[model samples]
Target: MKIYIVGSVGSGKTTLARKVSAKLQVPHFETDNFVWTRHLKGDIRNEIEVRDQLLQDAIILDHWVIEGVHKDWTDPGLQVADQIIFLDFPSQKRVQRIVKRYIYQLLRIEKANYKPTFSMFLRMFKWNKYFEEQMKPEFIMKCNVYDHKLYRFQTDKEVKDWFHQIQRG
Candidate 1:
């Protein structure tokens, strides 16, 4: 089960990937890990060839679940994915999650890959807005060719029910 989950930040891609990966016993990965070299201070972007190669290696595997906000560089994963989940939640809902997650990270309730700063917090909202205005429409256009394998959900219940159905049948 090669599943690729995509959405804007705070759309719950990581949570859904964890759940699906656990239920299916498939390895899970984050495109962020490929896109940026994680560091204690700040993440550095990986070279394009390095990022592409890493993604290629992962998608070529037997069973995996990968999630991210990445688009252009991830077309190969989209092409190979047995299933693609897009959590196209409304902007307000996503913004709320971003706030909640940032708070959690600030209080050390939740771990973050990078330092949780006010600047970073502000950037998340900015990214979300950019995603709403640009990324979503671009993704919709790019993913139309993969409609047969794509499963888009706007609500948690709908996603859960659809996932359960897939697990059963």
Candidate 2:
């Protein structure tokens, strides 16, 4: 089973994905790792090719969870996804997470493939705007349009509960 988790920046999509993947003992493919050249360089990596390869490899396997923001750009990755999870935390929570994330990045504490930049906060705000103004409705529409099972969570606790449910199943 392949699961896809999507949400605005700082929405805990990656955190939830990691939990789900760990619970299921499934590999988690983070698009950020494939899309960025360095931790924060934002250089153009083969977004399409790498994403496609990851999807192809996972499809041939039995289980995995893929998560990221570039849902439209990674349409192929979502094709075989059995579940789609979206984090809909409040703006304040999102802001807090983003700020914490940036602080960690600035301190070189968050060692993910992406780096934190000064503009990351602005980007976070813009991302929130885009999601609120555009991506949310579009995502709901596409979720229904595609007829895939979609799960929405408002808090980290809910996400944790869902992970337990997945584990129990």
Candidate 3:
């Protein structure tokens, strides 16, 4: 099974993807890995061609879960996904989660795959706002194209229930 999870930052896309990956014994791919290159200079985004190639490699897997906050760049995965999970958690809850996660990363309590910085923390809030104000409506509209494969959840409880149902099946 191939799954694609899309949502705003801190909407639990990564968390849900990890859980599904563990339960299904499938590899989980994060768009951040393809988008950002770790370097001493800074975290630089890969060229579009490079990012596309990396994403193509992951999605071609027999079974996998790919999760990200990216929309346009994720279209390939969306096209191929057997199931698309849209985490539609409230903005307030998402903001809270982002703050908590930022704190954990800052305190070194959580090991972040990417470098944690105050600027990045600030950007998270901006990104969240941008998502709510701009990207969300566009996303919803785009998702209609894949309505048959879409499974949207507005709460963590709903997400958990859906995950459990998938596990049972």
Global lDDT of each model? Answer: 0.92, 0.77, 0.92
- The lDDT leader among the candidates is 1
lDDT at 40 for candidate 3?
A: 71
Model 1, global lDDT: 0.92
Give the per-residue lDDT of model 2 (tens digit) for 1-169. 6888988888987877888778788998777766655523356666667756755776567788888877676776666778878888887888888889888878887754544567766888888878877888888777785564778889878888888888888
TM-scores, one per candidate: 0.95, 0.84, 0.95
**Model 1 spans > 4 angstroms off:** none
Question: Which of the two, 1 or 2, has more lDDT?
Answer: 1
Q: Rank the candidates by lDDT, best first.
A: 1, 3, 2
Q: Which residue pairs in candidate 3 have backbone atoms (N, alpha carbon, C) closer than 3 angstroms, thus clashing?
A: none
Error of 2 at 25 (Å): 1.7
User: What is the C-alpha lDDT profile of model 3 across 14-54, one tens digit per residue?
Assistant: 88899999999999999998998877767898999999999
Compare candidates 1 and 3 on lDDT and give the better one: 1
Give the distance in Å from residue 58's predicted Cα in candidate 1 to where it truly belongs.
Answer: 0.4
Worst 10 residues of 1 by lDDT: 160-169
